[model samples]
Target: MKDLKDLTAIKLKAYTPVKSIRTSWNVPISDFARLTHNPIRAIVEGLKIVPNPDKQLIALSIGDPTTFGNLKPAPEVVEAVRRVIEDGSSNGYGPSNGFLEAREAVAEYVAHQGAVTPNDVILCSGCSCSLDLCISALAGAGQNILVPKPGFSIYRTLAEGFGVECRYYDLMPEQNWEVDLSQLETLIDGNTAALIITNPSNPCGSVFSKSHLKAIINIAEKHFLPIIADEIYEHFVFPGYEFHSVSSLSEKVPVLSCGGLTKRFLVPGWRMGWIIIHDRDNHFRDVRKGLANLSARILGANTMVQGALPDILRNTPTAFYDDLVSTLYRHAEIAYKSIKQIRGLRPIMPGGAMYMMIGIEIERYPEYETDLDFVQALIAEQSVFCLPGQCFEYPNYMRIVLTVPEEMITEACKRLTEFCEKHYKMDDRIILQQQNGLLARMNQY
Candidate 1:
């Protein structure tokens, strides 16, 4: 044994570095770094350090409707949820697909747009969850999904986390944020699983025209890929613009319609959403099964919300929805008007939803080289916060959620203008050098 050991140990191999453990721990931080340290959060965090009660900050970073006094569901919807909780009927676990009545209500609600049936709908936690489940069910690692540039950040983040490549299709700003069909067509290939379209888009806030929806469907048909239609902001259109559901277009194409109670009903915290397979040609049977399986795996959405669906859908008066639309329209108008006065920013009038993208004239402001830098600077100087364009994949742009109090919008825009004006004269070499130094220092830690 000693002789064997001596012979084997004659020469030992040098220790090789084990391939770095390469944990996916940094994915969340890396994926959402901007959001994690979002200027809004920084402002709130900084406010926590101050002892003053008179000075409060205004937030324009999130699309929460509650800040605008859009609280409480319609009386009918409230009573519906109340009845369920009071009777304890919905306390127990319900069907994984959601209660039949809830599914039926969803089907009827969607049917007003076009032909959709109960078989087409699957209730989920929220629009975000619906997107996650749909993406998971359709594609996997190495597969590609086409998303709109300057679109919802969540889609890109979720798709990337799932190892799916997010190929961006440009939304033409000059064309009222319509999908650039040629650009979209070029991005699709055999490996592409789906194309996600956010109608009344998240950050851009432009609603798709009927022609635009048709063009998108044609592209999906040409590529033989399914369509994930995010219509969470479907009914939030302004007076002139109407939201056209992709399902209203060619039933030949498989449309996975994603929607929820959050935007229209103003109860985002409730987290009730649905994914309907609007496959008139029966092309999405496999995709539908996959979605159903995913839904089952996640159990089901909130039973109280699901139980409230029937009343929410059937009982809530059209007057309530009309009022909601009118309120949002007024707020959008106020925001658009106020932002126009800001020198370095230009906003596209949003047709629907609670957001608008303002183009940052970086050339006009020499102190800021990027949208993120500009936004952070504004937050620090004015105590007003907004999401940078890069968050939505739009460089040199920023998104302002217009759901804040109408009075605040005026002041927010005023501060923004002041900040831009103060920093506008950076042609001097000294100022430029100082800015670079400041940016470098900020990036260091």
Candidate 2:
């Protein structure tokens, strides 16, 4: 053998980039992998979109609040995270459920959920993960879960991925997206495992009142079903409305309430969320253990964030949330007012959350076969993209995110007005109505 230095040089000189080998082997994919799909991603990515070169693209399709950079976390939140990192205590693995202190912080933060404690809380990677754990723990193969139509698509994505069936109950948009109680009752059967209620709903953004929530719980009480409450948008009610957690109203029903710092904290990537088990009669005693077992699969959420939880939950000023909600409320008004003025579109005003759904009269725009076609054409011409209703299993409508900057919201509305005017086919009845309105305006002058 050569000397040590000479041997090292020889080894370095002998190194070569390995090339990938071509193999004839074909591995079969599992049914689970093949069957699991995200409808939003599939529909959005599958579109052959070509935006207009003259106008810049304004994407109102994403749900993230920080997408526009107009919103940001408070200094206290940042400082807390920094302190956690500097202390170096959070670098190691935490308990599978979560750090007791972190869980305690979450419990205190959501006290409105009724007597929440560290043991009642299980931290997850995010609200989506919290939801996943709840769904998987509550339901299994060949079982069914009832979800709202025109609801967030994640429930379907998670439920179906685990071989559980998702049965949809109708939400009457005209009734501020309230669940059709009669229809909801009919969907439940022997195989139904749980009922999913997304208050301050994602697509509709309609917050159900306390009475409505109580009515919903009554159904669950009667059916002997557990509830998976997606309250990630908790306390985000508009000025005129209030948000009531499904868990808070239930006396007998067990609720796995999912929430996190994703939206309200302006930190989606932080991946901090928790499930508050509110089982009044100890219905979720086994589920508490089940969630603990499920959490073990991912270990836990980010350790540093968990370390920062106490400060983040308690120290962040209330003013920050008030300002954020004010901005979103203003943006909601701008979109709703603008879209309401546009012909062939009926804008449903949302009580809270960061989205607005506008109904499309496809008959008035006969050139397009569906809402997808209308949105694609809007993207092609106006460079403004909104999510088609098909993503939520609701047709003849589209959803627009309200977290974009104000100027962009104004510009988007202008572009939408122009696009709708160009494509909207006014029938004789509409033309006559417009003429009459013009005469009334002229008479007033």
lDDT of 2 by residue, 133-250 (tens): 9999999999999999998999988988779999999999999999999999999999999999999899999999899899989999999999999999987778989988888788
- Model 1 C-alpha lDDT per residue in residues 182-286, reported as the tens digit of each score: 878888777999888889898888988888788888878877888888889998888788778888776678888899998778788899999888777778778
Candidate 1 colliding pairs: none
lDDT of each: 0.80, 0.93
Q: Measured by TM-score, how close is model 1 to the native structure?
A: 0.83
Model 1, residue 387: distance off in Å is: 0.5
Residue pairs with colliding backbones in model 2 are none
When summed lDDT is taken over every stretch of 10 residues in candidate 1, the lowest stretch is 46-55
User: What's the CA error at residue 24 for candidate 1, in Å?
Assistant: 20
How close is every model to the real structure, measured as TM-score? 0.83, 0.92
